[model samples]
Target: MRNARFEGKVAVITGGSGGIGAAVARRLASEGAAVAIGYRGNKDAADALVDELAANGGRAIAVQADAADAEQTQALIDRVVTEFGRLDVLVSCAGIEHFDALENITPDDFDRVFAVNTRGQLFAVQHAAAHMGAGGRIVLTSSVSASKAFFGHTLYAASKAAVEAMVLNLSAELGEKGITINAIAPGGTATAMAVEYGAGYLHPELAGKTSLSDWLKTQVALKRLAEPSEVAAGYAFLASDDAAYMTGRTLQYDGGMF
Candidate 1:
């Protein structure tokens, strides 16, 4: 049973069709918040999630949008507010990753990554902040790669680093608005993106077999990779009234990986 704690809140989750975004959308909706899910592709998955939420007596809509596009991002925020009557929470989980050495990374890949991870996040927050009132919450999905200089992740790491910086800056700017902006930097978890990225180097299904808990035991103090739901718990807390005093912080949830 869910806590049923967000009885009257409204939330918007970008990249909500899959992975951590979908987990967070379900979590928030289960807790009683109305959710508008944003997706770039995967229309079927997005619609299915909306239907699932509605069938379970939760309010939800799947809006097609590319976070990398400013106009589309703004329109997504407008649609959520229009449908829900208000926007209280914003979860920016749309991102792209490319695995390549620093020298081999192309300009296009670097630009695309930043366009979604950093620029897109900024624009999403900008539009959401304009519509949100006091006590509004903004959560960006960052990664531990932001801080770790992982090999073959030069572009991806650079993009995540920018996102971390944005979260801190946005928190300071939005303080007067009574809105809190924060980020979550999670370590490796089993997701489609991870699977695709790891397939060439490892087995095709290696990502699926691996769990955050397994990694946590070795490199992480906690001995695991974080489940998407586990990361979603952090989003829930940050979005809740319980975290009212918190802002401009990045909660690293990588099983205590240093």
Candidate 2:
């Protein structure tokens, strides 16, 4: 990727309270884009982040909106444009993980994960695209599991698979309109969700018993999990004019997962 900038633009990042969402928000703001940070919960974290960014002369606002709710999702789009005057980019990072084998997974589990991860993202892009014209960008979060099956991650993997497929089709549908749609499929990222559900619980042996760092390092060919900032770097590229020619693609940010 080339050096990219978002000067004088506007971006909305869903699930912007913490983790990758917050990282992306800060990165975009630093590059001169006014950002709307949407979070379903974690007001303190979101508000504090907004304050920090504003103190640094960055434009940002924290909004409470559940991506899974179509009404609220549309409202989020309206609010970003209402505040910033125009919408240039939409990044849907809202997602949840419920790990279990196929037989152990429940219907509600499937619905809940898909509701926010896949369905919510679709509505967010739809509403954002409706408000945006040419040069609009849409980046959705996906996972390595979407392509490589992970044990006990049946539901979560399926949800990401849905996102990957939707983004491909969306790219084709939005191509004529000059709107680019793509996904960032991260692998072994150091997010709160990864710490809690992945390393902490699912792979406690890796987190507690041995050298956690070494354990995690061994899982990827590059010998480390990605920082959220690293993943956001890809988003920054996709949202910039540098990536204008790219669409219907999924950029994997894994450290070469083995």
Candidate 3:
């Protein structure tokens, strides 16, 4: 029998109920990592995914945890460790996007965005790092919008930029413990979050000029939005031994949007 890449590993994916998070959970489990999926409010979806993985002969479990809450985030890490015995990979894919003009952006909205996208991811790592030993890998989800200027994306962009910065800083801190920290910045993925943002909310200036779908295609060299699995593949690679030497860098999987 051919050996799987992660035969003896365990992985935890935040926001693993859907979109990129679900895709990553599937990918890691298929590669032989026992996976624990963390979801905020979608217990049904998370449970369904766990069933699907089991049907395919892969091991998986679902846990309910709000990433935006630090205590809950730490509990998530603890739950994964308890279930799988040890954690080898941590993929922080839980995030939110709030698109609104600067004049209309509320303090609460800004804080909420940062709470999930930045602060939550930071603590997830901080706590997960405790259980992760040598050869542990941490991959964060960032967005191409962080570096690109988009109307009404000030808060979302700022939060993601902070994520990338955290990846760089944590790499050095975690390196001494033999852990690798990195991020994947995707551009215009066709996830539910992206579709909602594209169809319903856009900058006031471009509101009626064109559809968000068409506008996004024109911006990407590929002329199309990425699939969740495509972005998940990058996460898989970064989590594997093949990327052991890589850390503190953000890989742009934006379909050449940069």
Candidate with top TM-score is 3
lDDT of each: 0.86, 0.88, 0.91
Between the candidate structures 1 and 3, which one is better when assessed by lDDT?
Answer: 3
What lDDT does model 1 reach? Answer: 0.86
Model 1 residue 239 lDDT? 86
Top lDDT prediction, candidate number:
3
Question: If ranked by lDDT, best first, what sequence of candidates would result?
Answer: 3, 2, 1
Candidate 2 clash total? 0
Ranking 1 against 2 by TM-score, winner:
2
**How do the residues 1-258 of candidate 3 rate in per-residue lDDT, one tens digit apiece?**
634888989999999999999999999998899999999999999999999999988999999999999999898899888887999999999998787778998889988999999999999999999999999999998988888887778899999999999999989999999999999998778888876776544456677888877776667688778999999999999999999999999999988873
Shift in Å, residue 48, candidate 1: 0.8
Every model's TM-score:
0.91, 0.93, 0.95
Encode model 2's per-residue lDDT on 26-99: one tens digit a residue. Answer: 89999889999999989999999999999988999999999889999999899999998999999999998877
In model 3, residue pairs whose N, Cα or C atoms come closer than 3 Å (at least 3 residues apart or on different chains), thus clashing, are none
Q: Which pairs of residues collide in model 1?
A: 212-224, 212-225, 213-224, 213-225, 216-223, 216-224, 217-223
- Model 3 ranges off by over 4 Å: 1-3, 199-205
